[model samples]
Target: MNRSVYLASTLLICGATFAQAAPITAISELSMSHSFIINGGSEPAGIEIDTEPNSLTQSADATSQVDRPGFTPTDTSDVQVGNSFSDPPTPFEAQRTNSQTNLGNGDVATASYDVSILVENDPDIGNAEEDPIRRAVERSGIAAVSNAADPINAEAASSFTNTRDYRFTNTTDDAISFNIVGQFEAEMRAEHNGPEGFARTSGSFEMLFETGPGVDITYFPVAPYLITVDEDDPGASVAEMFFADDGAIAGVTFSGGASAIADGTQVEASLTAQTRYVFSITLEGGASMLLETAFTQVNAVQVAVPTATPVPLPASLPLLLAGLGGVAVLRRRRG
Candidate 1:
């Protein structure tokens, strides 16, 4: 064959081999969901009282009365909800054998005071304490309290009592909120040196919350758990998923914007083995959203790797080579 024809044939063969060698594979595709719970509580309520000496009689044939102070244990548990109590248990009557104890030798009168405060519709379980979300709530609550108090009298001795109630509800269609309460017990000791010499005083206290539903009672800093992901159909694309505490999705990350996963978008997620992911997806501008959970599927594609494809050579190379060969054959025949 002529030089042109030989070059053309070589080009055609290279194009076919390059096309077969091209790689077309799918890369990584992953889906994930965030699990959340809602928690809240009402304000505490109580009362305070102040008393002063009323009278004093001197060394004459006269009588006088003195003022005394007393306080009753406020029934904080009455307004508290979701706390469990033992049945057929010993009543306070058994606990308190007598009322009124007197100390010191002096003619004294007593003043008794009682007050009550109400707290309603608060969250008591998940997200109720030092968690990130609860921290924000606590900070806000503290700010409100600070603003309400008199700055000059902030440290004055004042009696405070308040009854609070809390509730936790699972609103997610596919997932349920697990409500838990944690109790912390600790002791603090301090040593001081006075005219009497070194002395140490240690105090211990316990805090309890009346969970309206039940008491979970766990330690602080609970470990994280696995959130599930939903499965996408073959060749189908999933856009975004919404997450909420106790299922309130509004104004949350899933509401919209950067945090949302849009159509044709890619997501990379690393999940612990043997863990589950529960997710809910609400389409853009759609009225309803779908909730799904990930499970162990043998054929499920956990990871993906993308492949690259090569460029194809010109298609006219083979035709050009055949035409050049025909010209060479004609010239040979004429000769």
Candidate 2:
């Protein structure tokens, strides 16, 4: 009694915002990723469970003189799973923080910065039957500025969110099915130097493939697919956007901008499916006010699960030589 046993769950969200001015330099970055792999000879054998619970936060702040007197400002924050211990496994190396501020020469001086992360999950079981498991996550944001003389202001912001749930059943009895190949990416960068310097970046993504239960699940489309961009924007007050969504094969949206000098944008997508899947991404960015200097960076999300190749057969085999010439002409008319 096997009815193709396979279940999965995941939910991710993101947010961002940054502004700059005064000998300004601005940078904004973002990231969100997901990966999956199933083995047992494609499916049907048995055990295949996964688990990943996470929640992370990162922060950085800088402020310049509020009127007089030094007033050096810089703030930092790091949180793991709402506190109380017992939840931390996603840092895998890549927790960053930066803040800088100076107020002395000019008149209006200021500097601001931000970075954020959020991950949520529950329901995990391990045992991929025998190898074949990969999971990933990335959250980023960066802001930079140079050329200050009072009349200074700067800001940076970043965000992240992660969630996971996967289960594949079939303790024998046969009957199982699962296959998924994936890819998602987005990146942006900007630089400015006068004419009110400015920079911008944005993001939105979603993926869903389901069946049965809770509000009746049903989604299609997950077949031969490919969308490209890989990098664009040479300058000239640049601007860019990426899109995807035609019912089911769902999710994809990105934005870019430039003013006074630099620009950057990157995008990519490739997918294939045979069942359970869920995805999400959200991002934002901005830069403003700059007498001469600005920089901004943004990364929407990058997810990959490469490993699914087996689609060849068309070298003019002509239906296997016409079924071997009809079994040798029926064995030469039975000799």
Candidate of highest lDDT: 2
TM-score of 1: 0.16
Query: Candidate 2 lDDT, tens digit per residue, 1-335?
Result: 01000000000000011223333332222232333333312432353332312311222333222333453555554543221122642323223333333344322222222222222222132222111233333333433333333222333333332223233333444333344333344343334332222333333223232222211222223432333222233322333333333342233222333222222122211111122232321111111110010012232111111124523223222112122222222222211
Q: Which ranges of candidate 1 are over 4 A from the true structure?
A: 1-133, 136-175, 179-187, 193-207, 211-335
Top-TM-score candidate index: 2
Shift of residue 51 alpha carbon in model 1, Å:
31
Candidate 1: tens digits of C-alpha lDDT, residues 44-150: 11111011122111110111111234312121111112211323111111000001111221111111111111112223222122111111110000000000111
Worst 10 residues of 2 by lDDT: 1-10
What are the models' TM-scores? 0.16, 0.32
lDDT of residue 284 for candidate 1: 19
Residue runs of model 2 more than 4 Å from their true location after superposition: 1-22, 31-45, 50-75, 82-97, 103-140, 146-175, 179-187, 194-335
lDDT of 1: 0.18
lDDT for each candidate structure: 0.18, 0.28
